[model samples]
Target chain A: MAESVSEVRAWVNQRRGEGRTIGLVPTMGFLHDGHLSLVKRAKAAGHAVVMSIFVNPLQFGPGEDYDRYPRDIARDRKLAERTGVDLLFTPSVEEMYPRALQVTLRVGDLANRLCGLSRPGHFDGVATVVAKLFHIVEPDEAFFGEKDYQQLRIIQTMVEDLNLPVKVIGCPTVREADGLAMSSRNRYLSPEERRRAAVLSRALFDAARRCREGTTRAAELVQSVTQQLSSAGLEVEYVSAVREEDLGQVDQIDQPCRLLAAVRVGETRLIDNVALEAGKGMGHVSAYVDR
Target chain B: MAESVSEVRAWVNQRRGEGRTIGLVPTMGFLHDGHLSLVKRAKAAGHAVVMSIFVNPLQFGPGEDYDRYPRDIARDRKLAERTGVDLLFTPSVEEMYPRALQVTLRVGDLANRLCGLSRPGHFDGVATVVAKLFHIVEPDEAFFGEKDYQQLRIIQTMVEDLNLPVKVIGCPTVREADGLAMSSRNRYLSPEERRRAAVLSRALFDAARRCREGTTRAAELVQSVTQQLSSAGLEVEYVSAVREEDLGQVDQIDQPCRLLAAVRVGETRLIDNVALEAGKGMGHVSAYVDR
Candidate 1:
């Protein structure tokens, strides 16, 4: 475990110098099964896995719970080691933003939809910090979970636009047995809220099933998902079908699409998404959605 | 010479596979002695040099001379060959920006002063394009001429703030016999404007001398240099003393400083700077200024 940026660079460089490829799993601490799945995928690919645990304050908005974001260094360390993580980087805020950040990296259009509509400046913060980590780690490939579907697409766009050398590998979204997507913020839910949080995924899975059942209209899918969540006593923030590529809103599901939604269950917010295949819609629904 | 980003990357990666270090010299074509000096420095340091010549539209304001920027691939190729440049990257606008630029990279306080004041969005364009080039080239060291002193500082800050792995080397500003700084835009000056352009450097060199001779007040030094520029029948844009690192306007020359000025002779705008050593400022003036 290294807490300093320079130390981690030295470790990664030493391994690279010896011709070993590196795979990075970037996460905010409080390790969940979803994060470990990425680590497992990295190790499975014969990469010396480096998992970064930085609760990046940049990705949280002013009103968001940056201060209350979950953190447990000791537990996180144990979880990472158990998952066969080769190195763990936990840098302090001072180490990351030593001075006021003057550089603002804003990815247009793609960031203004989905989660970005409610939490502005979130993906810019994500892109900037991710860019910093990419430079610091210089990994051949980096892993991300599909639970942050918008975030994964944004990073992919940023990498393509910037011509970044690293390949982005997005793993499947790990979920609870009841269908709630596993997330670091899942801990913020109350016992009852946790039970209701499953509705977010359930609603999306239901809508995805409707799409597979020959429902072509995006409005119909959105209306069905919104009704399902509202009936479950969740405040629906946004329920829409967007193209998997640029996240553009799709009126008719003619292509591979991502049915995404965000909802407020009590004071906690939960987001989940499921991929809908274009032609063989129902054939792959079971793979993306946990039954 | 490679005209596309992919071709250049392929060539660079092939060299990297053989363990050869690369040094990048990024420029707008009209190959000057200043650029060749960078190539010489790179080769002197045992690096294979890749020089890029693209008149980036992003670095130009809407009304700036991006369209009229000097470009001559034939002459540039001859000069680069004479200087022993290993490769030349001259990507077109379409190649560099395949789509509308969704990502905007803005360097805060550092980019909002000096040259940035007159030409808004210039440094943002510079920062963004440079970032793209950095990713594409993946150079071990990148070179910039100190003639654009504020630009040099801005790029340094960007690299440091972003934790970019490449080292930024600021080469001494190459000057003409009459002390005019070499720039591709210098060709914009009429022969008569060219004669008076030397006054920009002379005024800065003179102020730097006064600072060494115990002229401590920044306002006094600015006044003297401004008067010199105005007396030469040039329309002075600005003449100020600033701390070297941040370009913050300084009140007293108590530390290492820069005396910078911008002026317009007829329709041509020119800029020059002189670095002042804290106690003995004039000690290094001749290296940056021509007699």
Candidate 2:
């Protein structure tokens, strides 16, 4: 049966009262193959899958593409039904945030680097809204894509530090053919910009290759990737290497490192990453690594 | 069956899997008769009460009595058992906040007025910790006392604004025979100071008398109470006549007004209030004249 957010919350509570497990897959309303994978994983884990479709305003920065973010509720609903989602919590902006949100959840130093530094207040918004959703959903386990590597790390830190009950399962980064990371924003790129956007993955691969070929310094790898993206006619926002788990700046490839990059192809921004581990005189590369 | 916090959380999740309703009552340990009243209210409302006892450090301002706060774990355990709490989450500060809590919950204008003005960051601390606790407990209904009227209002606003799953229930303020409001801080007062603290209620009652006896201007009532407390040798912090609901400052006593005061007698501080309709003129004086 079609359910409202409150109805699903009631259903979940009733099930919990009887001792049953619930799993949640949080998603923006433009359902694609990536979100379906999360739904499938949640259902297969023997949980009543609840998928929440909310484009959290806090996650979007001023002058960013919040207004243009792709959304298709009718299509998302059909897709959720097809994927066996037991409940779909599609709350309005007003329903999710009835008044101005005064409390903000931030992860300190971790949030001050990488995507957080570039987008300002982005992860704070992500952490706060996700924390609110976790409270509302009260799921035993929550699924997240590894494509948002920094987000995954920040959430893990939040859940651990805050002792939130839900178990965070990091799913593999779903990708398109040509090595492009699948995202709702991928739909916003023009065909020409789409082709140029492939450089995000290519640049990450090239940085990993250099790391494997004894390019140990992070600054060197970042410089090389920046040049490559610029040469590819893409406006590079940031191309840096950092510690794999914490996303902190690294001087050298002393341990596992993530080569992450973001670039704008025309008006569309794209992000991708590859993990590298230092070996004797060389490094080994892992494509689409989970933080 | 008796259970730990983790075990009870798991048990609650299991029931949620099957479908049930859960209620929560958050308390600092040393559960008193007032706390029990809240528990009984929860039980009567058909909620499986999950009571939490953690001396939240964030709520305490620097040099404002965090270390010397009363703690009686064994006694609290016995009280929880007696109150028939379904789950008693007694996490240490380390368990609830493993790392530094940088995020703060601010209630905007509401936080900067009244008790908030005297106790800077006090309600912010309350809001943040409560938001975190709300996430952890994920209760259907959460109960609080109107004794901390500002706190009750803040929590209610947080739940409504954040779209949290929990419903906030405000219970009436429990009090002592001499009319002093019940607070853990009451334990800090010297015997003489404790006795004199009753004057807080006395002064508010006097203000209410003035309001009912044709004194329509709030400033006049506030001035009279301030003089009364000052003459009693107590250092008055603030005495204001404000709106009963939002706690906003009012020029005239047309609506239901609250006469509130806080004073420091020796090293101890006390707060109290009384509600009266401001525009009732002399007819209302008999109803609240004597005690």
Best by TM-score: 1
- Over A1-291, each residue of candidate 2 has an lDDT whose tens digit, in order, gives 333557777888787767679999988779877788888888889998889998999899999988888999988989999989988888788767766775556567787877777799898888888887887778999999877888888888777766677899988776677778889999988898888888888787777777777888889888988998999999988887888667888989989788788888888888877776554434434455332
- The number of clashing residue pairs in model 1 is 1
DockQ of each: 0.76, 0.40
**Model 1 lDDT at residue A24:** 94
Q: What's the TM-score of every candidate structure?
A: 0.97, 0.86
Supply the global lDDT for candidate 1.
0.88
lDDT of 1 by residue, A160-191 (tens): 88888899998898878987888889988989
The residue-by-residue lDDT of candidate 1 on B10-43, one tens digit each, is 9999999898999999999899899999999999
What tier of docking accuracy does candidate 2 attain? acceptable
Clashes of 2: 21
Q: Where in model 1 is the C-alpha error above 4 Å?
A: A278-281, A286-291, B286-291
RMSD of each: 1.6, 4.1
Number of backbone collisions per candidate: 1, 21
Model 2: per-residue lDDT, tens digit, B59-174?
88888878888888788888878988877887777767766754445566777888888789898788878877776667888999766777887898777665576789987656
